[model samples]
Target: MTFFAPRDAETSLHCPDCGTRLHIARSCREVHMYCPACRAHYPLREYIHRADEAMERFLENVYCDRIE
Candidate 1:
């Protein structure tokens, strides 16, 4: 579960590992993300914490929060 705000709904975000779009689950207490493209899991915010740590920020924002 996550503690994302309602504003997170309209925001664009994605997973750091697979580079797939992600959704904000308010029911969650922390920011958790996953990439359908690669089926990888990672912590939110930290997704883009570094350059070599994950994919490009632009690519991560591609399908961010567009799906549930």
Candidate 2:
């Protein structure tokens, strides 16, 4: 079978204001990281979404590789 999407890769999140790319960093139990684009920061929810998406793709890739 053919695979789609990046394997275990982080999603490139762009800033809404300046279009600067952002990376997710786990802060404290309360927060995540800074937005380079808007300069307005966000919470863990955003990190969770990105992390989950990356993790899912990661697992899928590992499984697919093993199967082949």
Candidate 3:
């Protein structure tokens, strides 16, 4: 069974390897993402972490710009 946050449901997912659309597979503690185009399989946790970091950096930049 696959469970995703409501926010994730709204965004499109793509494979990092082949630029193909990714579909979520079984989900428990970690979610599996598969790329049919490239036969790539990986966990979504890493991608979520990366996205969180990027968002934090972007927010920091925006805050700095506002203060300046």
Candidate 4:
């Protein structure tokens, strides 16, 4: 079945300016991110990139035993 609204996925995005956790909803079409704390809208790509970077850092720490 086809859907109109965006698909819900678990995501943890932090505002680059305020460090506030941001919510994400993915869609078949393009979508942008709006941060209420900072009153700014960021491209979806930017949010994804940030998320990727964060995950990479976390994995590195875990593998290197930096996190306990």
Candidate 5:
């Protein structure tokens, strides 16, 4: 099963390959951009500049867990 953070529709992040909207998804240890239509995963560093509210929320949770 895929684990994705809640998406923010106002975020305009899109897949580089298919132009589909990207979602914030996490694996066992990391979070990144995921394109459901293209089934592609992109590293956060590559898209951090374009991050929106959803990505920000996901990152906050990730770091909070690590700190505690």
Candidate 6:
């Protein structure tokens, strides 16, 4: 069973390894990019500059408590 549902990145970001589109997924207190084909995870910081609407929303929820 999965706890969180991952959202597809709205940008045209491609995986470096498998050349597959990446998905924005979040764990308890963090968010990152994941490649389904390669099963590899990337740090959010690496893609923040290219974040899309979905990524923005996820970031807001993840950091809401620290915003103030």
Candidate ranking under lDDT, highest first, comes to: 6, 5, 4, 3, 2, 1
Off by over 4 Å in 2: 1-11, 31-33, 46-68
Q: Candidate 4: which stretches are off by over 4 Å? A: 1-10, 25-29, 50-68
Ranking by TM-score: 5, 6, 3, 4, 2, 1
Winner by lDDT between candidate 6 and candidate 2: 6
Tens-digit lDDT track of model 4 for 1-68: 97343333324677788877655443445345556667666666665445554344333322222222
Candidate number that wins on lDDT, 1 or 3 = 3
Candidate 6 lDDT tens digits, 1-68: 75554444444578899899888876677767899888889987888778777777666546433221
Higher-TM-score candidate among 1 and 3? 3
Cα misplacement distance, residue 48 of candidate 5 (Å) = 0.9
TM-scores for the candidates: 0.30, 0.39, 0.44, 0.44, 0.70, 0.66
Each model's Cα RMSD: 10.9, 10.3, 10.8, 10.5, 6.0, 5.0
Instruction: Give the winner by TM-score.
Output: 5
lDDT of 2 by residue, 1-68 (tens): 98564312334566555667654443223224456556656553544445556444444434222221
Winner of 1 and 6 under lDDT: 6
Identify the candidate with maximal lDDT. 6
Which candidate, 4 or 6, has the higher TM-score? Answer: 6
Tell me the tens digit of each residue's lDDT in model 5 across 1-68.
97655432223698889998887776667767778888888877787777787677667656433221
Candidate 1 lDDT over 1-68, as tens digits, reads 86422423312455655546754323334445555456665554554443332244333434445223
**Which one wins by lDDT: 5 or 6?**
6
Residue pairs in clash, model 2 = none
The residue-by-residue lDDT of candidate 3 on 1-68, one tens digit each, is: 97433212211467788888665444434345577778788755545444443334333323122221
Q: What overall lDDT goes with each candidate model? A: 0.43, 0.46, 0.48, 0.50, 0.68, 0.70
Residue 4 in model 2: lDDT? 62
lDDT measured at residue 48 in model 2 versus the true structure, 0 to 100: 48
